[model samples]
Target: MRNPLSDTIVNIPPSGIRKFFDVVSEMKGAISLGVGEPDFDTPWHIREEGIYSLEKGRTFYTSNSGLKELRQEICHYLKRRQRLEYDPNTEVMVTVGGSEAIDIALRAMLNPGDEVLIPQPSYVSYVPCTVLAGGTPVIIELEEKDEFRLTPEKLLEKITPKTKVLILPFPNNPTGAIMNRTDLEAIAKVIEEKDLFVLSDEIYSELTYSGKHVSIAEISGMRDRTVLINGFSKAYAMTGWRLGYAAAPALILKQMLKIHQFAIMCAPTTSQYAAVDALRNGDEDIARMKKAYDERRRYLLREFRALGMDCFEPYGAFYMFPCIKRFGMTSDEFANRLLQEEKLALVPGTAFGNCGEGYLRVSYAYSLEDLQKAIERIKRFVARLDGEKKC
Candidate 1:
């Protein structure tokens, strides 16, 4: 009856993106360009594998690290795509989505007051998870001019003697930004020289619109010090499958698996079986979905620019961070008005971090038809704002 909650947990804020989503859910005839989910179904082949697993009654638990087959497939997939190698037996572990991999990795590594350098306008889970892991979250604000990438200079500015980890959220979420090889090499040099470890969240690796996605773990000296996290959710339209993985050095993985062993037991057996199929046969599915997403991304950029809205052309992820500063409203205010007046929902950029002020994260994962409808509404809404500015 005394203190019901820990002060630490009580002080953390809820996700800012959910507020608009909850409102849009109840509003009639609302169109949402908010949620970062694929419009496509889990490809028929992938779904069939899950059905087959259930039909075969493979419903029991897999090993805590996951079905050996799925882990090995994950290793092969990474090697094929990223040129990275891992021992499936000791270096890989399946998790309950990338979120779990993130949580357990932080728990395995951090001690109280260990500073974690996190760049702004990144996935919301990083800061909260770092805090829960007993690490102090040091925010490094990424610049719009830098395309929301974490620059080496900016990263260096935040590092302290207590800095223990850097969370690299690239092919970034809200901003759709990606760090090319040169961009990464510069940052990797700093990390190596500073002797800092990394938590590279590459869940969107398969969704990049430009050249191939590069993992910081691919850097010469970094894999041993990096935990590479990825999953099928974004890549395979397998969100509900709840399967993800982490490939880390055996020493670090041993500790992470210990936490996962007690906390999660294992990822879903059916999902694991299906994921092996995905890793093996889903490359075509990924390419197909990415093609559609890129088309939508380009269409939205053209529409936003044609309306004279300032939006940077993003090269990765399915979200677009368009500046709403010209409308003279804060992101939350503009998004709120857009939802009320037009029944169109988008995530306020500030939902990711303070640096996202004056911007909105528009997801292109919705269909081209849905995107066209949403744009008509946005067009109308912005026209009125334009008229008001002139008056």
Candidate 2:
């Protein structure tokens, strides 16, 4: 028998974040600041909606694009939250999660050997999804000095004739960098000039700590060229529900739906029903959770600074990217040694991209109590390292 495996599938490395998460899961009394999931459970009202759907025997599959009501609610939510408009009938489709939407979008858009400009350190899925879609992954190494925001200069430098998709992963993972309107307008100018499309992953949009989250899709001349990806996972703590959606021009959405229809049929029905409730009535829930996350974010920033580490003050999402270069070790080495010696798990920044090598992504998604304990352990580890250096 031939040893048969497609090089594309085999060559893709496993998620770097999950490797550490799994190790921490098996260890007794381990505190993980690694996983990006919200520590809060799904808001009760949203869960009640899912339960209500089940009770009413609404378990049948939705249309390939998803339940009409749910899609309308998604469109409404996007409009209310981000000032972006979409037609539920033709522009929106529910997905399993933001992950599935991302995969299908790439598949629908990429021609073989097309180049996708991905900025790092970003969410882990972008590179692999682009690769599996038969696209070339062109990485833009986002710099710490810029707070990890992707500049228009960097964007222009990476563009070429083959560049087809620019992945905008703002309120960025690993690094909690966000692009405000001015920042986005600069990039949009380039995209319009170059005739490129954008896949804007705004999964963390609702988690922004600063002013309201801005969508590049809302910029002039951008809506037709942007596929906006967002979901309830971060804001409503609905990660387990596995519901997300993509909104784009009808033409792009039609192609994406074809792939989704054949591959996934539709997102889970119960999840979609619950998501409708989430969108329609979950604003207060978002404010409540965002407040909690903000408290944790500030606490972590203060603690990290007090511990004598250089941490970027994250204005979005629930993670902080702290520079660990002072420790004179690679991100992996610091993370592994901290986990082994202190029973605290932090993801190495390199997990996101090589640009993350000197940093560590510490999620503040845990409770203040857990974060306090983790900080204590981390401080002890750092102190020990400093003492050794002095010796």
Candidate 3:
């Protein structure tokens, strides 16, 4: 007997983030700050719309491009929030989630051996999707000193003849960093200079605290070259709903639609109907959730500092990437011991990339009660480690 799996997948290890998540899942009484999803329900109105659609027997498969009304809503949301315009009919395609949109976009754009510039530590899917699509993932390690943002100088240094696209993951994951307009414009200058296409993942755009979210597509000359990937996951708390959309140049969108047409057929019809409600009537929910996350963000930053971990105050997203290098333990070892000793689960920095090595990503998506418990647990864990060191 012989193994029949493809070498590309067989050689690759499982997702580092998921490895701990699987361990945590089977444990009793474990509070998970490990996942990047919100704890809220998808608002009453959004739920009602899905229910209403089902009641009306609107369960048939929708057009491959998704519901027209939902796309229009997405168009309005993008323009109203980030000042990016897209013709909903030709330039947009609704995918199962931002994850699927990411996959399809890479497949539609990159030829074999094409290189895509990705900034770390980013969402985990970009590098894997690039490889699966036969493209090379050229990771640019974002610096902690620069608030973990991808600077133009760093980007420019990474590009070569094979660089086909750049994947912009901000407001970023794990690091909870955001790029303001000035930061975006500086990179926009390089994008124009290089004539590179971009996959801008702005799923956490609504979760920014310090400044307004600026889309690269809003910059001049970028609208045509940038493929905007956003969805109802983060801001609307619709993660399990599996609803996300992509906006791109008509030609690029058409090609992506073909992939979606074949691979997914269409996004879930009920979710599409519910997403319209989320777009039209979920602003208050977004505001409420953002407020809670902001409060948690501030509290966690204060706690991390008090606990002796050097933390960069996150301005966006619901995670805090605090440097635990002072503890003199590798991120993975610390994370595992913390879980075993104190029953707390956190993603190790190296899960995101090598640049993430000395830190730990702590998600603030739990309730204040849960967060407080986690903090106490972590404090005791650190104290135990300190006592052991002194001994």
Candidate 4:
């Protein structure tokens, strides 16, 4: 038999976040802060909407683009939340999740050998998606000092003639970083001058601890060149709803929709109906959950700092990237030893990218009680490491 896999697919490693999550799953009495999922249930109103759709016998596939109502609501959301306008009829698309939008956006944009500028310590899917799209992944290593926001200088250093797209994974995943408007303006200037398109993943937009989350599409001259991706998973606790959206220029979106229909046909009928409700009546639910997450974020930051852990202030997302360097152990080693000795599971930093060494991604999506328990275990585990260091 011939080799069963394409070389491109074969070389890509599985998600680093899931490794510790799998181990902790089988271990007894384990406390996992690994997965970046919300602790809240899908808000009652949103779930009820899905049930109503099913009760009404609306369980068929939506259009290739998605339910017209949902797409319109998505556009309203962009307009109302981000001060940006999109045409639901031609410029918006509903996807399986933000992950799908990322994949297809790359597929729709890149040709053979196109270079994509991807900053490291970002969400895990960007590099693999670029490769699968036949684009070369050029990594821009974000600095801790920069709070993981992409700088124009860093972006300029990596761009080549082949560079076609830049991925803006702000309100970032593992590091919990966000690029303020000024930071984005500088990046916008570079992208516009270089004539690059961008994939701005703003799935965590609603979960920001700072002020309102700004989209790069809001930048002058950027609306036409940016694909703005977002979803209900982080904001409305709708992760299992398996829904997300992208707002792009009509020309680009037309191509993306073609791929979406051939591959997926449409998003779930029930999810789309429910998402319409989420957009229309779920602002309060988002405010409630975001409040809880912010509390948890502050609590974790305080606790970690009190323990003398070195972590910069992360203004967005629910994850914290804390430096584990003082313990003189690799992030994987530290995470593994904590799991083995204390049955606590947190993902290793190196799982994100090579530059993520000496750090660990800690999620605040768990409850305060669970977080407190996890902290007790971490406190004990690190004390042991402190003792070992003395020896």
Q: What lDDT does each candidate get?
A: 0.93, 0.93, 0.91, 0.92
**Candidate 2: where are CA atoms >4 Å away?**
none
Residue-level lDDT of model 1, residues 1-391, one tens digit each, is 7988899999999988788888888999999988888989999999999999999999999999999999899999999999999999999999999999999999999999999998989899999999999999999998889888888899999999999999999999999999999898999999999999999999999998788999998877889999999999999999999989999999999999999988889999999999999999999999999999999999999999998888889999899999988888999899999999999999999999999999999999999999999999999999999989899
lDDT of 2 by residue, 267-298 (tens): 99999999888888898999999999999999
lDDT for model 2: 0.93
Candidate 4 has its poorest 10 consecutive residues by lDDT at 17-26
Among these predictions, the greatest lDDT belongs to 1
Report clash pairs, candidate 4: none
Candidate 3 lDDT over 278-387, as tens digits, reads 98889999999999999999999999899888998899989999998988999999999988777789999988988999999899988988999999999999899889
Pairs of residues clashing in candidate 2 = none
Model 1 bad stretches (over 4 Å):
none
TM-score of each: 0.99, 0.99, 0.98, 0.99
